[model samples]
Structure formats: C-alpha cells, structure tokens
Target chain A: MRLFKRQNNVLPGFGLTLGFTIFYLSVIVLIPLSALVFRTSGLTWGEFVTTVTAPRVLASYKVTFGSAMIAALINSVFGVLVAWVLVRYRFPGRRIVDALVDLPFALPTAVAGITLATIYSPNGWVGRFLEPHGIKVAFTPVGIVLAMTFIGLPFVVRTVQPVIEEIEIELEEAASCLGANRWQTLQLVIFPMLLPSILTGFALSFARAVGEYGSIIFIAGNMPMVSEITPLLIITKLEQFDYRGATAIACVMLLTSFSMLLVINLLQKWSRRYAD
Target chain B: MSAPVTSIPTSNGSKKRTQTEPAAVRWLLISIALVFLTLFLALPLFAVFTQAFEKGLTVHLEALKEPDTLSSIKLTLITAAVTVPLNLFFGVTAAWAIAKFSFPGKNLLITLIDLPFSVSPVISGLIYVLIFGLQGWLGPWLQAHDIRIVFAVPGIILATIFVTFPFVARELIPLMEAQGKEEEEAALVLGASGLQTFFRVTLPNVKWGIIYGVILCNARAMGEFGAVSVVSGHIRGMTNTVPLHVEILYNEYNYTAAFAVASLLAFLALITLAVKTVAEWKVRQQLDNN
Candidate 1:
C-alpha cells in the first residue's frame, strides 16, 4: 500500500468552502477576538489583579451576576407557565400572544430599558400604584431584576415551548391511570422530561441577562456599588481611557460566560439523549 | 407525539382545545399568560406609542425630523445596510464549510464563531478598541496612517457586525445539515461545476433559511447599542446610532422625542417580527408539501 493513500471524499466544495470559512472567520471573528486576549496579555499579573479586583468592579459583578440569577430563576418558573399555556390551550389572539413573547428579542434593549423605567418609575403607571403602597421598583435592584426578566423571558419560553410540544400526553394519561393527581403527574412525569429544557432556558436567560447593559442601565439608576453592572463599569473604564482595566474586567466576563456556555451545551446533549 | 394522531392535529385551532385539563385550571393558566404578557410586553409597547405622542402628532413628527435624530436614523440604516450583507456573506461561507464538510477542529471552529453571542456587547466593542484604539497594538500604526476607527462610523459598523455575526450561520447550519449532501452530490456527479451546483441547487433549497437569517441579522445590526456606544464616543449627529440617540434624548429629558425615536426602533422590531412570522409560516408550508 502507498504510504499516503489519497482518499476521495464525495462532497464537493470542501477546499473552496473551507478556505473562505477560515479566512472569513479569521478576519471578522477569530482575529478580532484574539486581539482582545492579546491586548489583555500586555498587563502584568499585579496590574491585572488590581484592575479586576477594584472595589467598584467587584461590586458591579455582584449586582450583575446576582440580579441575573434572580431574574433567570424567575423566568425559569414563569416562562414555563407561559410556554405551557401557549402549547396546551387555544384562545383568541393566540398568534399575537405567541408573537408578543419575542418582544424582548426584537425590541432594542435601550428602548426596553427606558420604557420599563418609565412605567416602573414612581410617577408612572405601575409605579404609581406601587408608590402609595410603600413599594418602589425603579432605580432599585428590583428594577434590574425586572429588566433582566423582561429581556430573559424569551430565552426560556422559546426553549421550553418546543419541548412542551414534543411532550407526549400519553405519559401524563398513563400516570393518571396509575392514580397520580395532576400535580403529582406534572411533578414526576412531566417535570423530569422538562427539567433539562428548563435548565437550558435558565442558562440562556442568565447568559443574556448577565451581559445586559442597555436595558438595565436606564432602569438600574447606575448608582456606584449598588445598581452598577459589570458591563456598565467596563464602559466606564473605557471612557476614562483605562484600557487595561477595561480589558481585564471584560476578560473576567468572557471567561465566566464561556464556562456557562459549556454547561449549557452539555445540558443540551443530555436532553437530546434523554429525549431519544 | 406518541399521542393519538387521529385524536387531534397539533398547533393552533386544532380539536385539541381544552385537552382533558379542567376548565378552572385552563382558565387560570390563560389568565396568568395574559396578565404576564400584558404587564411585560403590551404595557411597554403601549407606553412607547403613548409617550411618543404625548405632546401630539406634530411634536412627534418634529422629533423625527430633528437634524440629529435624522442623522441617527440615517446612521442606523447605513450600519445595518453594511453589517447585514457583510455578515450574510460570512455566515453563508461558514455554514457551507461547517455543514458540508468533515474537518479537523470543526467543533472548535463553530464554538469560536459562536463566541460573540455570549460576549457582552460592551466587551464586543471594547475588544475592537483594544485592537485599534490609542495605545492599542495597532493604535500607533493606525494613528501614523491617520486612519480613524474607534470613534467613527467604521467602528460602529464593526461592533454591529461582531454582535450579529452568528445569525445567518446559526439559521443556515442546522437547515443545511438536515438537508444533507445528497442533492449537492447528485448535481456534481451530473457534471455541474461546483459554483453552478451551489447557485442552482443548494441556494434554492436554503433560500428561506437565508432570508430568515438576513432578517435576524438586520434586526440585531440596527438595534445594537452597548458595543456601538463604547466605540461611538456619543458624538451627536456624527456617529450616534438610533439606540444611542434614544439614550441621548432621554438623558436630556427630551421625553417626547426620546420615545418618538424609540418608536422608530420599535417600528423596525415590529416589521422584523411580522416578516419573521410570515417567513415561518411559509417554511412550515414548504415542509408540509415536501
């Protein structure tokens, strides 16, 4: 046999497509992103540490990640309810309702931010009702969570909606015949099948909410060490020409989100296998 | 589903309405869904139009006609026009490679391509600044050449492109993979050149997916804010995109104009969603016929 056997692949355009793919990816995505990491590499270890661990940046991290998790958890529960209703029921304007679920995906985040802020402000519609009752939402961490929840809802609803459609009602009936009530049937039969998707939705929502800036900034009050988000802080750093500081904080966000993405991929794989 | 297909068809307006669940439970679920959408989606949407027209139709019209606002609109359209086509090309190229070929590091390549999705928009712009800003790696070289990127239209376009890079590829990848290489191979074996096979056979098959991807790409490109803001330097009328213009208007307490500008963006979103719904319906129809 020849030392190098040239096996012919049946598919065409392998060379041309692959060449364009690499060249395009490198120019647009890979190269630019590598520039980010390379820029960060210019910092010394101490400078990087001090830059990242600044008190305000650390505080922003808490608000950003904390509110993101809280909002995603909220979406995880309510989004399922929304998805369940959409999948299970027929009603007037159902198409409009289904389309409306993607409002956050379509609307600009800054618009969402300002609109949410306006309605939730003390003088505004919903906030007026709450204000007399000694409850405030806008300019608080609550507003951050609200904005996050608003933007994050679609991730959960869209993710779980398809899974709900795929869910076989026979299994629910089977559970019922075995004397399980609706709640128990959902808890056991339905919930287990839905858990993987719910988690995936939660992760997606968290990923989006954590990076959210335009929506949250307007509603969040942007108070130092309180409502400040990591993204805003990064922008603040860049504005002040603190390039090293900005890149370091950005690097942290990049690493954290990358890990979250990894977990999401694994969960998706598990869901696929379990579904089969 | 493993359920009795004969019992009912899936999707809207099926005999599946009120499926064995109790009336009260169904009503409750419906109420929750309605109330939630009303509060979160409908309220904000209503508020935008109401606040925009709060002063009246004339004021809103005047707001849209303001010089800075006009420029912002122009800038947004230009940005989307540039980034969407660029990303469309990149997306189709990447999807062609990743979907149609078996290669080493394919998964890693895909992950890299998808990297910007999870990236913070602020970071998306910040990275470019690092590459092309003052004191950046190429900053000195670029300055020597007297080329401006960081605080210019080019920077805004770059940031928009970065944020929206994955849309077309994301749409096309799964569609192409599902369609597989059979039709493509048959065309090739019949003596069509590679480009001819692609243009005639593969492109036609994936046309809807491409349009769907372009719609999504254009939406995000026009709507991007945080990244573009970082690089844009907020130079009014010069570099401010619509989202940034909205922020400026609002911050100046120009509430009516702010909402009016926002209404324009909302209009874009509405059209994007409407077109998307029609595209999806068409896709479903095609799937059924096939």
Candidate 2:
C-alpha cells in the first residue's frame, strides 16, 4: 500500500479525517456510557448487589433472559426457513413476501406491541379462537415470547438471506451425486456452509430480544416475577425514584449483554474459520 | 457423453425424480408462510381497525378529536422533526469520516455507534433520567439554571435521539465504504474543493441511503414508548406521546380510544413503509446504473 500517495485527489489529509471521527464518536457515545458507569459506581458493593439481585429483579431477569433465549431459538429455525424460501424459489408474490420479512424492522416497536396485545387479548379475534382451547396469550409469559419472536424474527431472516443467496447450488448437487441422501446432503454440504451465518443471525436476534422493551411491555401483563422484564424493572425503579437502584441494575444488564455478545462474536469467528 | 445405460438402477432413478421435488414443494412452502404471516401480522392490524369501528365512526371521531390525543400527535411529530435532522447531520459526518479514513480505535468507534442498537431502550431511557432527574448528579446544577429535563419534553427528545441515532449512520457506512475514494479523488484532482466535491459528487451518491435511514429514524421516533414512558411521567395533554396516550386510555378501560389512536400511528407507519419502498427502489436503480 502506498502509505502517503494521494489518491486521484479525493479528500486530502487522512489524519485530519481520522481525528474528527474519533472526537465525534467519543463525545457522542463513549462519554455518555462511561458517565452511566461512573454514576452506578456511587453505590456501595452491598448496595449494588442488593439493587440488582432483589427478588423482583431476579424474577425479571429470569423472564427477560429466559424468554429472549427461547424466542431466539424459535426464530433461528423458522427464520432460516423463511430466508431459504425467499432466496431459492421464484414464486408469485415473492417480492411481497420478501418485503414483509422486513416489516418488523420498519414497524414501530410500540405499535407492534399494542397490536399484538389487542389481537391476543381474550376477546380479540385470534385470541377468541385460542381461548376456547384454554390457551391464554396476552398478559402472560407466553405473550412476552410472542412479542420478542415478532420483532426478533427479521434479524435472523435478513442476516441469513444474503448468505443463502450467495451459496452455490452445485455443492448440494455434488453431495447427492456422491450417493448421499437428502438429509445427508443437507447435513454434509448445506448446513456446514450456512452454520456461521445462521449463528450470526441467531446472535443478532438474541441480542435484540434481550434488549427489547416497548413491544413486550404492552403484551407482557407485567405482573411481578412472572411477566415483568428487566427493562421494565429498570423503568419501575426509575419511576419509584430509585436512581442508584436503576443505575445498578442497568450496569449489570449492560455488562451481561456485552459479555454475551463478545462470546457470540468469538463463536462466529471460529465457525467461519472452520467452514473455510 | 457416456453411452446410455442398458438399465437404470431403481434407486438412482428415484434420486433423479426427487430432484424436481423442490419445485413442487415450493408452492406448499409459500402458502404456509402466507398463512402464518396473515395470522400473525395482518390479523392483528385488522383487529385494531375493527375495534376502532366497533363503537361506530362517531365515537372513533370523538376519540380522535380529544385534546390529549391531538397534543400527543403534535408532540411526537415535533420530536421526530427535531431528532431526525440532527441525527442525519451527525450520521453523515461520522459515516464520512469512518469510511474515508483508518486510525486507532476505528473499530471501537464503530461498535460504540452500534451500542444503542444492542442496548435495550428501557436502559437507554433510565440512563438519561439517572443523569437529569431531581436526584441525579446534575440535578442541582440544572435546578439552579431554572432548567428541567426529567419529566419534560427535553427528556423525551433526548431518549428518542439516543435510540434512533444509529439508524442513519449504520445505513450509510457500508454504502459509502463500498463506493470508495476513486470518484472523490478524481473530483479533488480536478480542483474541486473538499466541501464542493462532497456536495457535488458524494452527496448525490449517498442521498438514498440517508433518506432510508431518516425514514426508519422517523418511524421509530414517532412510535417510541418504553424510553419516553419512563421519562415522560405520563403527564396527559402535556408530556404524553401517542403510545403513552394509548396506554393511558387502555388503563382507563377505554379500549375504543386506545385502538383509535393506535390505528392512527399504524397508518403513519404504513406511510413510512411507502416512503421506505421508494427510497430502496431509488437506491436499487442507482446500483444498477453504476
């Protein structure tokens, strides 16, 4: 690489541009997050632990993290199928189906929650059918899963769709020609190739689900220890004027999410290298 | 080509026949997806419309005319107007710098920009309150200056900005990076000043991406609930946004009013979808031409 050669003449001075970028991001993002950590540090160690580990907070952690994991798992399977259908086939209304896969991305989370709650409430159209069968959705843990699944599905689908499109059909055909059965062909050829991208999709969906608040709150019924999510807990603490408590809980969540994401990124890198 | 086989093995023949199975199964798959989406997405939206009409148009209209509902809409639009433009400027400048240069902490800055996307909105709202609330670190200073941030419009706007800031920047980074420095270099070589070349060449190239990001930011800002709710204090007709307004009505057992306002926001989202489609189509056209 020509270290200092001026390209045709574009923007001069790479040093100047890089400085601006660092200063801009530092001021806007890093400072604010660091301030959050600094504020939470005001609490004593015992207070910090108690604030984040209270019975109600523990219940919220279970609901938020547990439902998010389950929802991400469900999305990983179905989102793969949705992406496969969009990429591998040419059908009537294909464009519309492709577009709708992005609906969750475009729809406002609040409106999505409100709509889901309305449709799943006892007398709501779909809920009416389920109620006869004794299945309650809205205001339950089940509804939290549904809301998370609704918003998280697109993350998995969109992430995997491009990788699916890029994969060559010849690999599957080659596997079949080698006397492999359909299941074998999928397992030996396609699945290995897709594993890394699928996991990327899963990680993205999981992260989104864990952080989700608006869409779940409307449908979650928000009963203590049952339907309340971590985000809701943080909000509840804030409303109650528990500033130290809110910051402490938020710090725990931030650290946990960051570590999980770090682990997922490592897994993704290993899988990609393995496939290559 | 090899000579035709004297007799084809049954198993091999069946394998060949199954090659076309995917074509046949494709329709079955499409139908299943269509039904699933209708049940989950379309039906729920339909439920909102039906609930709005259940009390007759007169009541629905009355709900719309309510002062609180109107104020919520106004406040939401004003916040979107303020936040989106500011983010657009910041997004473009940051994206430009990131794409055009490399330095220490480049990757870290990218991750920082995406932090809001990964962090929960609930936490985002709480962070702002923890800073500006009456008991917050800056509370005394803000009070001394006769400025109130928490439970006010400024708090709502700040929360909205935090969550939506990443949208436009995320959209433009990859697009701008891929376009690279060739055209920009050519313009610069021709004596086009830095700002002039950017406006004349670069801006046209990235405008569609910017528009798409703005559309997304606007949609999220208008319908933001968790963050705003945490900070707004739910002051009806004062600090309430539409989503908060709907929640209040729903809490009061006013289902008609709740769904009516929700329907309005849903309609606005539909318009957003339309704008997004146009923006995407424009970008696609540009890509094809290039």
Candidate 3:
C-alpha cells in the first residue's frame, strides 16, 4: 500500500525501539502465553474435554463465573454511585474518599483476602452485627462475591467517573424542559450516555474477578466443589503435578476470556456509535 | 426555575449543584458514598493495622524482625527494584515506537502488551513454569545446566514484569500520541542527536505520565501475589515474598504476625496511593495549564 511511504522521520531509533518492543513482548508475554495453548494442544480431544469438564473443574467454573458476574453487577451499581458522588457532589473528605477508591489496586490480594476474611467472619466487626440476623458472608459464595466486588470497584468507578464529568448540565436541562422529571431525566438522558462505559467497566470487573486467586482462596473456604474458584483449581492441579490438566484448564480460561473481551470490545465500538 | 423551587434552601447547599441535583438528593448521595466507602474501603485497611497492633507494638515489631519476614521484605525490594526499571525501559521504548510511527499491527502490539492484565495472574506465573519448571520445556536443559528460573528470584521477576508490562507503555502511548512528533521533528531539524532529542523533548513532555506509570508498576510489582505464588514454590526465607509470608503466618494461626507483615504492604499501598494522588494532581495541573 505504501509505494512511497512518507519520510517525515523525527530523531532516529524507530527501528531500535520497535525491534526492542517486539523482542521484549515476544519473550515475556506472547511466547509464555502461547506455550500454554501449545501444551494444551498435546492433549487428545477426549482428554481436553474431560480435563476441562471434570465435575470439580466444572464446579469451579460455575463458582468463578457466577460470583464474578454477581460481583460485577453489584459494582456496576455502587461504582456508578461513587462516580456520581465524586463528579457531582463535593463533600468534606472527598479527596480522601476519592483516593481510597484505589486502595484495592495497591493492596496485595493476599492481604485483602485475609483482612476481609477476618472482618466478615462471624466474629468480625461487621459480621457481629449481621450474624444475629443470619446473614453470613465469609467463606461462602457471598464472600467470594464481596471480595470480587471490592477489587472490581476501582475499575467501574475510574472508567465511569470521567464519562460522568464529561456529561453536560445543558443536556439535563434540555431533558427537564421536555417534561421529564429528575428521575426520568437521569434515566432517559444521563444513563444512556453512560451505558457504554458502565458496560465496559462491568466487563472489566467481571474479567478480573474470573481470574482472581490470591484474594478469593482465603475467604473462599476452598471447599472443592462448593466455593473453589478456577484459578485455585488450576493451582491445585499444578501442586498435584498435573501439568497437562493445569495447562488444559488454563487454556480454556485464556480462550474464553479473550473471546469474551473481544466481543465486549466490538460491542463497545458499536455502542459508541450512539454517542455521536 | 432558579427562584427557589419548592422551598429548597439555598443557604446550606453550594450553588454548584443547584442546576443538576437537589440539595436533599445531594446529601443522600454523599451519605451513601461515605458509608459504602467506610464499609468496603476504610475498614479493611483499618483491620490490617488494628490487627497488626492487637497484641501490642512490641509483638508486631518482633514479627517484622523475624528472619523469614525480613528476608521476604528484602526479596520483595529486590524484585521491585529489578522489575520496575526493566519494565520502564520496555514501556518507554514501546511508547516511542507506537506513538511516533503509524505501522500495521500497532493495535495488536498494544493489546499484546496488555495480555497479562486480562490473563489470570495464576496463568501468568503458570506460563513461565510451563517454559522453565522441572517438567517444563526447558526444565531438563535448565536442570542439566543448574539454572533455576522458575521457583526462584528470576521467576518472581519475570512474573512481576509480565503483570506490569502495560503500565508505563499504556500511560505514555496516549500521552505521546497527544503530544505528537512535532516537537521531536523540530529537535531533529535543529541537528540534535536522537537520544538528545528524546531526553530534551519527548521525555520532558511525558515525565509526569512516566512517573505515574512507574509508580503504579512498582506498586503492582511489589503487591503481585497470585502470579508470583504460582511460580515461587513458597520456600521460606528464600522465595516466600512478603505476601506469601503473610499467608504462612496466617496459616500457622499467628494472626498478629500475619497482620504485622501485611501492615508493611498496607503501608506501601498507602504511600503508593499518596504519591499517585500527587502525580495525578500534577497531571491535572499540567492539563489545565495547557
């Protein structure tokens, strides 16, 4: 296509930088990730199916995907609330609260798990309040959901906050002038504009939660079929020296997550068409 | 509409939200935000510190002084020191190429750089093990040569690097893209050397973005657990990082000790957050100036 490529070259080293970028990306990320699929390819069809669809592995998929979905949904709601607050309202300690939104990103997953597990246990600070009401959170699917929600919050909030800030007050005024009440204006006017980003945030949070391991394992009770997650299961297979099985499971997750994200990306592109 | 809609007081509330939100609704939103943050964000952090000091400061201090704990701290420091700079190099190089040139597969390159972010952390570590572990592709070769990659410091560094691959590049790509090549083109026209142009022009433009990215990458490299755990074999005082050490202490029913080691990481998180906020503020200030 480039019969005569433009030579508006700046300071040189384009070759050097591009070469290094490809080399480092190849060695560290591409090759290693490809190795998983390559190793999985060694499996027979029956072997692959059985390994990925084994009862326990299947259960883990259910737990991981189900909890992640619930967590993403919860985050979608609250994360928007938080973003709304940050963008629209200015209360005292707003900066501190804003900074706190990112704590999960910096905090070690292991630390988050242990701390959350302790705090939500039956004898925990908040747990003590809820225990008498028969509301259990730690060491169940709910605990998994809670952990996922915590870690996923930053994603939704960060993504949506900027979009909210971009929303014009004139648009809301226009909606109200069209005989829409405040609730109707927010629902029909503001929410549609924010939907694409909220969906992106939800997809991101869901993806993270699906692959989460260190945090979930502690509060998860690690009950094999009941509450165990896929990542931990992959670890268990490795610990048991089941390399083939481990790679097989890892391959499934890799493909599904990649395809899912690809679809979401396309959907986002489609959604942005409405924004214009 | 501006003239006192239905007895809503204008005194207590800022005039900022009068057009967008009712005063009562604003208060409600703020209250929910506060309580939700207190429950989800504040308490867990508080728990980490309060539990660390539950058995008094002496015991907590002793936990940090434990040989394995101290070693874990040392290993974590070394891991971050090595990984952050290496990744930063890749980030700057990658950003330079992608931002300055319009090439085919450019988007694909960006996605590949971010591959580890979407992939499971366990899988991130597992991929390295598949290449270099005892039963890995190079396992026999590594064993014969007595070269340990997985289950050692090198593996930890690799996983940390993989997980943090996108941070600096992602930060700078958009920044450099926005800044464009006009400045660099001018520097070149002025007869500056390539590296000279980069240092004097490109680097200065993206300095804040790079700092923000580097800080985030370092925080992640230090706090990464699942990937490092998968590759690390959890050898005490050897491969067990601070996170794994916290796990070990917790498994041993040493709550105070676990939380003590964890507090160090929590402290790291706080410091990272603070610096990040400052960097963000600087970025915002620069944006406003422009």
Candidate 4:
C-alpha cells in the first residue's frame, strides 16, 4: 500500500501541472525560439558566416554591444546615485522626483524617439544652442547612446532603489565610527553590499538597450554601416524577404546575448555566496 | 559662542564644514538631476503640445475633427478595452497558479511568463507572423477556415497580448506571494466552492495589483508600435493605429497632423500615469491599514 501510494502520489499529482507548464511554454516561447534556430539551420556554414560577419553586420555588432555596454555602465553609476538620494533623503518634491523615474516606463518608445529626435535636432531647442558649439547630436552615434541611456536608466534606477532602501544606515555609521573616511566607507562598506544588485541592473539594462528598436530608429537615423543597429538590420532583411539572412544574423545575436546573460547570472550567484 | 570661536580647534571646524558640504553637494546633485529631467523629459513632452498647436490652435482643432483621427482614437480605445480585460484574467489566474501552488516546473513557468519582458517587441510580433502569416505553420489551416489574422485586427490583438502578457502577472505574483495562502485556505475550509472563494476572497485581495497591471498593459497596448507596424500592413483607414497613423502622417510630411496624433497618444499615456498613481496610492493605503 505504501509503495503504491508513493508511486501514485508525490506532491499531489505533479504530472498534471508539469504537463500544463511544458505545454504552455512550448507553445509560447520554446517553440518560437526553436523555429528561429530551425530557420537559420537551412543555411550552409559558409553562407551563415558570410551573412553574419559582413562589414556592415560587424559595424552594427560593434555599435549595438558597444553602445549598450557604455549606456549600461553609465546607468549603473548614475542609477546608484539617484537611488541613494531617493532612499537616504527626505526632501521637498521627493514624491515628484520619484514619480519621474517611472516616466520612461510609461512613455511610448516611439513617442520617446520622436521627442528625443526633435529635442536634439539641429534646429530644435537644445540642439540650436549646442549646434553653435559644433556639437552634433541628432543622427549621430552619440544620439543612439543618449536614447539608450534614456530608456535603460529607469531599469537600473528601479532595480537598485528598493535595494538601497532596504540597506541599514547603521552599517555606514559603524564604518565611520571605525575611523573610515567617507570615501573609504562608501567604497569598502556600502558598495560591496550593493554590487551584485547593481551588476544585475546593469545586465538587465544592457540587454534592454541592445534590443531596443522603436526609441532608437528615429534617433539613430538608420544610416547603414554607421548608426544602423542589428534590430534595424533584421527589419530591413525581413522587408527585403531575406528570411534566411535575417535568421542567420538573429541566431548570432541570440547566441551572444544568451551567453552574456548566463555570465551575468553566474556572477550574481557568486556575489550572493560572497555576501553570505 | 565667543569662547567657542577660540576654543574650537581648526580640525573640528573643518569637520563641521565638511559635514555641511554633503548637504550642499546633495542640493547641487538634486538640482542637476532635476534640470536634466526637466529638459529631457518635461520639455520634449511640452514641445509635443506646442508643435501640435503651433500652426494655429485651429489647425490642430480641425485635425482632431477629422473622422480618420477620431476613428483611430476609437480603435485604440476599443483595443485597449478588449485586451486589458483578457490579460487581466490570464495574468491573475497564472499568478495564482504559480504563487499559491507548489507545482512542478513552477519556476520555469515563472521565467516563461517573463520571457515577453526580455524579448524585443519586434520579435514578439514576428513570432505571431511566423505562426499566422501566409507562410506560417497555421496559415493553411487558418486559411481553410477563412480566418484572417495577418494584416488584420486579430493580428494586432495577438501582438499586444504577447508584449503585455507579463505585466499583470508580474505585478500579481509578488503581491500574492506576500499575502500568502492562509486566507484562501480558511475560505476553502469554510465550505466555499473554488469559484466562490476566488471571487469572494482572492479577487478582493488582488484587485489593486490587477488594476495597476491593467493600466500598465493598456498604456503599452495603446502605444505599441514595432509589433503592430509589422502586421498592420499600413492600411491607412482600416488598420492604422494611432502610433502607426502618426508615422504615416510623418512619412507624408504632414508634420502638423503627425504631432497632433502623437499628442493624442501622449495624452493617453498621461492618463495611464494618473491611474497608476492612484492605484499605487491605494496599494500603499491598504498596506498601511493591514
């Protein structure tokens, strides 16, 4: 009877829920990703390499990964500062400031792109002032970075803000009482504790920026081999009915992105162990 | 005080001065952040309104009067109206299953739910196209049934559903986990049927989270561009969403009309933010009372 019970029932019929979950995921996510991989498999190895490693494609990889990294790094620094302020202070208009952090979340990416483009165009308000100084913004790689930073900043801020709020102030006070200078206290005491979450935030922001399209297209100007991004290239390929070419490039991007995320996850696990 | 001026060492004075420095520095940092936000976020938003009305307020007013613009607005509202409710049901149910139950593959299912969050909207749309497009796996089957999905309203709805699937679910999971299952178990033990317990107990508890998620989902659905653009086929009056319409006008070099329609979408975003604020406030209030 015990053997039969053990065989028949472990955790109240796991078979049913497991089956449902697998079915749901297969239908929604796994199958679609496999289709992308399957589609790309139709290409020869030489053809796949040629498709993904062309000069224009290489330039896009540089721009996408390079700009995303820079933007994520920028957000990590500033996001921490912004989060620190929001958590540590009680100030007038704090509510408003906090609310504004979410604007990027709510604003439509296309609208954000248009607005950023207009604001940074040569004849527009901010652009008019900067143009006199020969600082071009709109239709430049710099503009791409700016747009990515705009969209990615909120992710970092939101992720880090709660963590900062939960950090006890007494730890900082204790470090100070132990004769640690302010900079020393910050670098040695607070930063190490917050490092993992910050890294996670950076990874999330970087991933988001790499895949961002709507907010970037207008600002990037889509100049081939220059401001053009990988996502834009994919769109172009699709428009031209180059299905095999698009999938080939997409596979490369997907593989690179998956690896990067995996490394970041590993780092997060390491940090958790160290903290413990 | 006179005695202190002489008695206080220079080191203490420096320490005091340095302490005040952070306050001043804090103010400076805050000002810089505020100024940047005002310029980048606030001004550009204000510019949308200004540009819309610049060619005489009458021009924009007349543009709003256009039946096409009104229809686009109506279409966007209807889509949001339909999609938000459907997603709410899915999100809440899924969150309940994942959070309250100790099921196999629960963690994997949670990750699957969040997959839409990480995937690009462009890809999200393409997945549907790959499934329902003329060359898709289901294309023949759907065609045999005379079901039109691609370049049609159904395509847009499916795309919206894909992108916004995580919002309500993401919102509810944490809330439900925090609330725990004790209350639901009590209701179950009290002889309430499953459906009755869900309505009388679970529904009330998760209402705010659901509302928050709905607002967010509606906002994104209304403003969704990349996914909708691919499947829309840009059929001006029929399949044109507000965002797509804005793009069409911009492409046609009708700058005034483009900004006008863009401003309308922006207004919808503003309304969403307002609702979000209220929902957040209600959640905070409930938390306090609890």
Best by TM-score: 3
Error in Å for residue A89 of model 4: 2.3
Query: What's the CA error at residue B280 for candidate 3, in Å?
Result: 1.4
For model 2, name the residue pairs that clash: A10-B185
In model 2 chain A, which range of ten residues has the least summed lDDT?
A1-10
State each candidate's chain A TM-score.
0.95, 0.93, 0.95, 0.91
Question: Deviation in angstroms for B26 in model 2?
Answer: 2.6
Q: Candidate 4 residues A48-118, lDDT tens each?
A: 99999999999999988898999899888888878877666556787777777777778888788887888
* Candidates in descending lDDT order: 3, 1, 2, 4
**Where does the lowest 10-residue lDDT sum fall in candidate 1 chain B?**
B4-13
Candidate 3: docking tier: medium
Which pairs of residues have clashing backbones in candidate 1?
A: none
Query: Model 1: per-residue lDDT, tens digit, B1-290?
Result: 25432233233433533235666777888998899889999999999989999999999999999999999999999999999888888888888888987879988888888888998888889888888888777889999999999899999999999899899998888888878888888887787887898899989888888888898888889899999999998999999999999999999999999999999989888998888887777666665555
Complex DockQ per candidate = 0.59, 0.44, 0.58, 0.31
A1-276 per-residue lDDT for model 3 (tens digits) = 131254656457888999999999999889898999999999999999999999999999999999999999999999999999987766778899999999999999999999999999999999889899999899889999999999999999998987787776777778877888888888888898999989999999999999998888889898989999999999999999999999999999999789867966775786568656
- Poorest lDDT segment (10 consecutive residues) of candidate 4 chain B: B1-10
Compared with the true structure, what per-residue lDDT tens digits does model 4 show for residues B37-136?
6765678778888888889888998887787787777777777787788778767767767777675666667767777777766777676776787777
DockQ-best of 1 and 2? 1
> Is model 4 an incorrect, acceptable, medium or high docking prediction?
acceptable
